[model samples]
Target: MIENLWKNIKKKEFSSIYLLYGSEAFLINETKQLVIQEAVDLDEEDFNLSSYDLEETAIEVALEDAETIPFLGERKVVLLHNPFFLTSEKTKSKVEHNVKKLEAYIKEPSPYTILVFVGNYEKLDERKKITKELKKNASILEAKKLTETELKNWMRQRASYNRVEMDEAALETMLQLAGTNLFLLTSEVDKMALYVQDSKLITKEIVEELVAKSLEQNIFSLVDKIITRKIDEALRIYYDLLKQNEEPLKILAIITNQFRLIYQVKGLAKTGYGQQQIASVLKVHPFRVKLAAGQAQKFTEEQLMKCISLFAEADYQMKTGGLPKNMIIEMILFQLNHDLRK
Candidate 1:
């Protein structure tokens, strides 16, 4: 697992060749930074650290650098970025790579150098000999996006790393408020951890107070309020969004998206699809599917379809200047509230 590999790296357990591949750019970047930070000193970076874009640079060039002795340091760190040849996808670059040289290097990598291949592609061409060789010989990390459970655990780990304790409610609220981006979550967690340093505890209240809500998250809250028959609260959220200069049509778009997800989640659940399966089919985060499932329980298919249709009409009116955009969204909110109340 990536976590174990990270632990090993932190302990200064160096590997000759490392393969970091996957769609999650954050994890891949994090692993690269961690390796670089641990492998080389600040002063030695000038001579010991090298990064080559495989799309533009030939494989033999990077390999030769990797084979070169470290300058004024015991170890050398080489980063190979965008190794597109490892994947089946063809790049626009006409630079031809020497795959045989890379394959040979993988077999007998330089012990004094740390060769890191950063493949941002989602998947490698597994059938290729170079990929197979790296898999067999190198320390590998497939930095795919974590699932909901993994995300929660990662949050807890981050908090713990900062010597703070986060309650379950705080964790869920953090996810809801911050969304699933690791970079944002990491920042928020560090901020909150510092805030609760005295008590060393992060509660839901603290999270709500400090975490900045994205526009989509505000729309989600607006929908939640509407579902619970709290039109006043929903309108307040809409007004707050407008105060922040959010475009009416953009807010409407997210509202429409939230209802559509609820509708889809409701329908999928009826047909025996679990949250993860539904997330896969819809190409969204599983945590989003979970939230939508809860909201779906309060909504019937007809009600959701009606809500969607109202947003569609509001969208058309807003675009054609039939009504003021703010009034259009307000009217849609009232209409949805009135319909849901029935």
Candidate 2:
């Protein structure tokens, strides 16, 4: 975890080589920024900090740069970005990398240099000799997506850092309102911190009043309203969405997505999967799983399945039929409400 890595960096513990590979852009960028802040002095950055895109230059050239001594500092940081050679994905870079050169450098790296290989890829080709050698020798940081527990812990820590206190309810509401996107959550946290700067306590009311819901989230709310038989409120939300110039087809697509998620959640829950486990299995954010689980509780398995089929049909008709999109969606919502009332 980056927190563990940060602990090492805090104690001035340095690694000769760091292989950071991940799909999470926020985590990768934050890791790189923190490393630079900890390792290189601002005044000597021009001379001590070096970055290369492997798509433009070869790995051997970056290795050569890593071998050099720092100009004005005790150590230099070399950032090798987009090392597509590590992944199985084919690259359009005209430059040819010497994997042998990189393998050799890994054997005996410079003590005064922090050689960081940054690949914006999910996984490295494990069968490759060069990939194996780098993993064996360097400090590897995989910025995988965080689980529900991990994200909450992160939020707690972030709240402490920002000098604000967020209650459990407020945090949960924030997660649902912003979804489980780290980048979006981070931005919302900053805004909430400023809003609660005086009182320093982020309450549920504050969260609900301040956090802006994504369109998908609003659709989820619409579903909740429908399930609770508040059809008037649900239609109000739908009208407000239309007022924002949101396409009815787009809205229908999201509604279909919600029904499908609820159906999936119901099936998974029947098999005794908890929210976090279901989230992992479904490759969705934990916050989303939690919300889906709640919605799933309001319907029988049969009802959820019927909802999915109805929306699937709506999706097909919207794409092919000449019917107005608003009417199609209204019919779907009305029929869903009617079905549940039975």
Candidate 3:
């Protein structure tokens, strides 16, 4: 886990070669920063720190720098970014990387240099020998998105790190409001931590008061209200979104997307697919799948299809100027609520 790796890095237990690869930019960036902060002093950054874009440069070039002695410092930190060769994806750059040199370097890395490979890729080419060798030799961190449980734990840890207590309801509310983006979540938690510093506790009310909802989250809540048959609350959220200058067509698109997800999740669940399986198949976060699953329970497949049809009609009317965009959404909401009541 990244937490274990972070703890080790904090203790100054350095690894000679580090591999950080995944789709999550926040995790990759955070781990890289933590390594650099713990490995070298500010004064040594000029001579001891180096970065190379592997797409434009050869791997051996970085290896040569890694082998070189650090000037005015005991250790050197070399950041190797965009190691596209590690993954199956091909890059536009024609720079030829000498994989043999990388393989040999991995086998016997320079003790005086901290070599970090930063591949912002979802997965590496596991069939490649160099990838296998590096995995065997280096400290690895696959900085992927965290699961719901992992996210909650990480938020708790972040609050604790800031000397604040985040209650369970607050955590859930934060997740609901902010979605699963780690960068936004970190900012919200830090801001709330500072807000409740005097009390040293974050309650659900504090979270509701502080965390700003994204457009997508607002759409989700609007859908949630509709599902619960709370037309007033749903309209209120829609009005609030309009006051914030959100386009009605954009809102309609997201509402359509959410209903589509609910339809897909419902169908998949009926076929015995688990939440993670559905998430993987749909290429969405598991938490989103979980929420869609709950919303799916309140809808039959046919009802979801009808909701999607209404959204489609709304989209057409908004684009064709048949009705005012705001009225189109309002009408769709009312139509959906009326259908649910029947």
Candidate 4:
């Protein structure tokens, strides 16, 4: 939900000091731009729009201005590009020396002045006292990456807002191809949207043509087949991917997940874990859990137990560099296929 902060952004409620720090610079920039657009009238730079790179300057210019009145001209926005100020103990302490100087100003930041701090640091010590003060005194919004579901939502929203309609399969395909990288997905989705302008409904076929195919090659269907004891279909898909250059370990990973799901679902169902609980236990989306749980019926409790050992062996082999990754995966598929047919 926090990943969708841009959707919840309200320009009017802009805070005095904003800490925009994250790997997802898109959110940081998008939110900052939205706030700036709302706060400043576009007529001219009535408020001094100053951007500072902390590597170059102390907080004196940025934090000190907190006391000064808006020049007769208008409000001044001091943009601190890098809060290396809060970076290390030495740098952070040097910066913290002015907590009072900043605190005095933060208490009543100039109405016309907006201080923006962008740390972009890899880590934030939320436990530190000064960190607590900065976080508490300012609007500390961390830009988090989107999860799979949230990424799906993002792709749809981006297409719809841009007047492009991507169907469910297409969106799913896009998500698969895009992986979890929001920044890359955002750009790729936009590019595809512009290309498919002629079509209101972007179909899976169109997605296949327009966007890149997913890495696993939709091996989820194979996951479904193997779990349902549809050995024939499962092997068919497995062989298809292998012939298409799909690595064995990759396929093994997906199949291992399948049996693990069966064992999980059966265990949970026996415990009355219900769909929701099973989904949570498996860390899979609920709809997917529901399907896997239904498919779990094909696996006897004994079969599930036995296969767990097989999967364990495969995982060990893969992790220990015990076998070529593909052979390790092929062995898993062969075991699952043999057991299913038996």
lDDT of each: 0.91, 0.87, 0.93, 0.68
Please say which candidate is ahead in TM-score: 1 or 4: 1
TM-score: model 2 vs. ground truth: 0.89
The best candidate in terms of TM-score: 3
Which consecutive 10 residues in model 1 have the weakest lDDT in total?
A: 331-340
Residues 219-250 of candidate 2 have per-residue lDDT tens digits of 99999999998888899999999999999989
TM-score of each: 0.94, 0.89, 0.94, 0.60
TM-score ranking of the models: 3, 1, 2, 4
Highest lDDT scorer: 3
RMSD in angstroms, candidate 2?
2.4
Candidate scoring better on lDDT of 2 and 3: 3
- Worst-scoring 10-residue span by lDDT in model 4: 89-98
* lDDT, ranked from best to worst: 3, 1, 2, 4
Task: Estimate, for each residue in 1-342, the C-alpha lDDT of model 3 and write its tens digit.
Answer: 787899999999999999999989899999999999999999889999999999899988899999999997799999999998888997798999999989888888898999999988999999999889989988999988889999999899999999999999999999999999999999999999999989999999999999999999999999999999999999999999999999888888998999999999999999999999999999999999999999999988889988888888778888888778899889889899999888
Q: Candidate 2, clashing residue pairs?
A: none
Instruction: Write out the backbone clash pairs for model 3.
Output: none
What candidate 2 gets wrong by more than 4 Å, as runs, is: 88-95, 272-277
Q: How much is 240 displaced in model 1, in angstroms?
A: 1.2
Which portions of model 3 miss their true places by more than 4 Å? Answer: none
